[model samples]
Target: MNTENRGAAQPPEPARGAGPGPAGAAPLVDPLAAVRAERDPAVDVYLTGTVFLDIIFTGLDSAPVRGTESWARGMGSSPGGVANMATALARLGLRTSLAAAFGDDHYGEYCWDALAQGEGIDLTPSRTVPGWHSPVTVSMAYEGERTMVSHGHEPPPGTAPPTPRCPPRTRAAVAALTPGEPAAWIAQAARLGTRIFADTGWDDTGRWDLAALPDLRYCEAFLPNAEEAMRYTGTDCPRAAAHALAERVPMAVVTLGADGAYAVDGGTGEAAEVPAIEVAALDPTGAGDVFVAGFVTGTLAGWPLADRLAFAGLTAALSVQEFGGSLSAPGWTEIAAWWRHVQRYDDQNPAALRRYAFLDGLLPGAGARSWPLRRAVPTIGFGRGT
Candidate 1:
């Protein structure tokens, strides 16, 4: 439980052999272990990308046809994309920062206020672009999958967002790995000693650009979903694609929707895989982003590959079971609650729950009474101006 070594991303050590675990099992470490784990993190993670005010419509059985209107059983809006990831990270008690542009409009103000007040996410580097409308995404959740349509206008003259600077204590970053983002941005971040975790979009052209590979080498991890991974590697198998992509970076993660996820670590030549948690998925939106957030958190926490993958999958599962995209990512309180419930109910799957055994050490005695459950989605709060 001694975490004096800041630079070591070592695997989690064996159980301390003491009073009880974080979730009420046998003793693992001292009661202050969670506090110690949270201490002195310069900046846990920095995220950069388009932050959107997502308008999500869920509980629809199918998409509306061109000539007809549709009815949704549920609807709500929260942050999406980078905003979603940042909110997820912050909810995990990580000191999270976001560098993105916002418009000088109501949507923009709403997003800024929500992220700053609701999530306690850092926005010092985030700017307001006047005379521009904040990006808005319309997400339709149906049949366990979500379709998103986003709209954003070019910012007014000279309203471009500033270049991102990696803070001295910033340990990790999440950024888009696409042609729109310059390689130098990542290079500069790397020079500052920040680990970059990159993600890319699906290739519509079907020609996975080999030209982009060299530029992505600066990243520590490249995460792409199963279809994208297969398209880029020319392999139908996700595991094969992950291994192939690992050749380009230190870590390659291929996310398979229901099958779970697969990872290959280049430094250790270690391969690990975790199955998706079995649960009724209400909305699949933001599940991938939540998984990435979990992966980054686990990596920053120095968890091993297997534990990281399992934790990532668990977070994703928790996200899909709820309504909104970013709003659905569970925090430590939810994890602790689930753990206690499983123990109380004597869940059938002992081995499966053990994958989350990592949660025990996260909170020493699991005194979640002090920690409030943080929800990301909201319609109105006490702060609405009269």
Candidate 2:
């Protein structure tokens, strides 16, 4: 997006004359300093919506036919949806908790274990609903895109129990508002002064309900991808669509897949856009969710909006290079490690370094370069060098 900055060995500052952009922050000199946050129970982020056992199939040859069979070279089963966002938040070192109903079935146990133990996410407020089968999503990834089919059963009214109480101190939540799903809880959370970061799922019926606009007033932030924003605002332009949606909420962030992202901060009456980090995407399944995770992390840290968007873009870019949905999210370890790896290369090769130039200003110092050398080198003796 900003090639000059991308290849200049330092990330660019928010351009001054950029049309209708948010106020600028100096180019992030040390990203860690720009985003210094802590684990505060009173201001932590809460993730909701039931977990799904994402059975991801990758390296597919072609789309499966109606009466034909297909095969994928790789497959991985991991947490999806809420877990996707939750894991990404935890990986970003955020104080995160999840509140949702889960099935007592095998899939439920798998997801619970993955989120609670594997990702170190707080699940104390989440419960398992008996007899309700766990949600399962079968994702087929090919050519940098994913096709997902999910199955779940929603208990009828009076039968379905309420979501377990979220952490008493939660300050924010990530949830979707569909037709039949609860909207009252959003108001309840709002009453508690929780900053709700809301997003909507795809509307298959093509009826982008205008009534839902009122529901968003309860949320502090509304994040939707370009297509979703366009569909809701009835405007194909991402910028106009973002400003249009900004009218209904405090902040409207429209995530443009490759074109990066656009946002309007109603609080400051400022709108800014940032470009996406270029990467060879392997599986883009949960990139959007990860982007939100980074954005929320930046918001909680009080970072500049431009920095938030850039960090989010980087997070999503790293995610696409890996396969599974939630499992693919990069932790701080990866970020720091890559920052060091990129520094070894010369700035003279700007085109080659452009991809990593942003890290120069963000990561603190040249992180530990390599592991300590061991006296005894273990070699299987496959080659003469051993």
lDDT of candidate 2 over 31-143, digit per residue (tens): 23444346534336776676788888888877777988898987777778788888777666565677666676777776766666555566666666666778888899987
Estimate, for each residue in 185-250, the C-alpha lDDT of model 1 and write its tens digit. 677778777888988886656568746555586789989999888888889899999999888889
Best by TM-score: 1
Off by over 4 Å in 2: 1-43, 155-161, 164-167, 179-182, 347-386
For every model shown, what is its TM-score relative to the native structure? 0.84, 0.78
For candidate 1, give the lDDT.
0.71
Model 2 residue 385 CA deviation in Å: 36
State the weakest 10-residue window (summed lDDT) of model 1.
1-10
Residue 213's lDDT within candidate 2 is 47
Mark the 10 consecutive residues where model 2 has the least summed lDDT.
1-10
RMSD of 2: 12.1
